[model samples]
Target: MESVRLNNGVEMPLVGLGTFKVRGYEAVYLVLDAALRHGYRSFDTASVYQNEADVGRVLKELLPKHGLSRTDVFITSKLAPRDHGAGAEAGCLRSLEALDCQYLDLYLVHWPGKQGCKSEDPGNPGWRQQSWEAMEGLYGSGRFRALGVSNYTEGHLRELLAKCRVKPAVLQVEYHPFLVQSQLLAFCRASGIHLQAYSSLGTGCLVAEPTVAGLAHSYGRTPAQVLLRWALQQGIGVIPKSTHPERIAQNAQLFDFHLAEEDMQALSGLHSDTRYCWDPRHVV
Candidate 1:
């Protein structure tokens, strides 16, 4: 797998297995096992995803079984909005306990909360800055190898940079062929922050889109592969989720091929500014 080095000098696999709605120990183990077998060493999860323990258990069992070690994997987990404020460190500690790991490869502030409440308010009271400070504390303590944010807009990032002692290492957001986020991508690149794309396959919409299907046929790849390759070519990390063994295997086969510049431009033209995840404006 290809990798992008974090500002902290930790190398992260460019493509990873994402567990969003994937549930249960059995389901997680199946997908993770398949992903490992297919050469995926990076795994992305969040507290709200509700399968951390499941993923942890599978990792513990499979690593020894496969003769791999904890250092061989790059595990990323997020701090939910509710866990912001004074509880931020506690929340990260709890997540570490849940995952049965000594430290996380990357820890992210899940969202910039609005008001004091994390779920309801669209604009919160110093929530983002507070959360960033807490994250910085954790990172300084060596609890997390790197720290970042998710669903953060340019304005949010600017605020973070202005007040932060430790600049964000990454920005995880909804990105895919149909929602290229070029301006944000360029900003992150210029700022030396890695861009991690969740829902890189267009959140399953690309699988059904005629453009993707036609491109897949022409390229002799699945729609999912085409979409993921597009993101990879743009230097954005991609985490695509699937439980099926075939799909998991297919998703990891992207390194063998390269998407042409013309094809990339054509794919970029497909953007409709569609977003399947939380809206940034509504987030904080």
Candidate 2:
């Protein structure tokens, strides 16, 4: 698998398995087992995903079967919104215990505000900062290899940068051809933060788009591969999820092909500011 070095100098695979709605023991096990067998070295999960324990158990049982160890793969989990302030450290510890690992390869603030709090809540900023401090402490203790945030906007990042003791190393967001965040991407690039794309397939909706289909036809590749390659070509790490064994193996086939510049432009042209996930810009 191709990897990128984060600001903290940790190597992270560009492609990983995303377990967002993927739950239960059998489901996680089957998908993770397929991913491991197909050369995926990273797995992304979160407290809100509600399957940390299932993921941990599956990995523990599957790693040895594939002749791998804990150090061989990267595991990333996020701090829940409910854990935004004083609950940060404990939430992180819960992930560690649930994943059955000594430390996490990467940990992120899942949202910019506390759960159940309004987006413009006056306390959001303070809560988020407090969470970062807690995360920094975890980083200091070597429990978190690197710290970052997900679903953060440029404003959210700027605010964090202004007061953070440790800079965020990665920013994961919902990025795809139809929702290109040019300014946010540029900011992250300038700030030395690696941009990781989740929902790269537009939550599986992009695969059926006519333009994407045409591009897939021209490239003789699956639409999913076309979409994932668009992100990989831009130096962004992507986590594409699928339960099918064939699709799991197919998504990993991205390393062999490169998207042409014009083709990339074509993909970029599809950007319409359409978002299939939560919008965090309003979170103060």
Candidate 3:
């Protein structure tokens, strides 16, 4: 798989397997096995996903079978919303323990606010700062190869940039043709923070969209592949989730083809500011 070098000099795979709702030993095992066989070298999970142990255990078993080791693949996990502020360190530690790894290749602050707090809660910024401090400590200690934030808008990122001792290396967000996030992308590019796309298929809605289907037909690719290739063409990393073995294999077939410039623009024209995942815009 292709990779992009982070601001901190760590390389992150352009494509990764997202384990959002994937759970259970057998399920994770089967999906991961198929992913490994199909050339996926990056795996994304989070504390709240409740499947870190399953992913870790399954990887430990599968890596040898694939003739690979821990360092051969990039592992990313996030700190949960409930673990914001003073709980940050413990949260990262728990993820490490659960994944049974010495360190995470990328560790992200999953959201901008605490779990139960209101979206505009005045205390949110302070909590975010506190969390970043602890995360920086972990990064300095080598527990995290890189530090990042997810679902942060430009405002949130500017706030962090103003006070952070160590800059964020990546920002993962819900990005697809419908939710293009062009301004945010420009800002991240200027600030040297790599933008990664989660929910690249717009929670599976875009896969069935007329525009996407038309393009998929023209390219002789699945709707999912067309959608993923759109993001990859722009240098954004993507973690598309799937439990079906054939779909998992098909999703990794993105690197073999490139979309024409006009076709890329056509996909970008579908932007309607639509978001199918959690909206963190109102989080103070």
- lDDT by residue (164-242, candidate 3, tens digit) is 9999999999999999999999999999999999999988899999999999999999999999999999999999999
For all predicted structures, in order, the TM-scores are 0.95, 0.99, 0.99
Instruction: Predict model 1's lDDT versus the native.
Output: 0.86
Clashes in predicted model 3: 0
Which segments of candidate 2 are over 4 A away from where they belong? none
As for candidate 3, its clashing pairs are none
Tens digits of per-residue lDDT for model 1 on 1-284? 99999887989999999999988988888888888888999999988899888888899999887779999999999997777776777888878988999889999988887335655454453766777788788788887899999988887888888889998898999998778788998999899999999988766877878877888888999999999998898889999899899999999899888878888888888889888877876554
For each candidate, the alpha-carbon lDDT, in order, equals 0.86, 0.95, 0.96
lDDT of 3: 0.96
Q: Is candidate 1 or candidate 3 better by lDDT?
A: 3
Candidate with better lDDT, 1 vs 2: 2
Cα deviation of 198, candidate 1, in Å: 0.7
lDDT of 1 at 33: 86
Model 1, poorest ten-residue lDDT window?
114-123
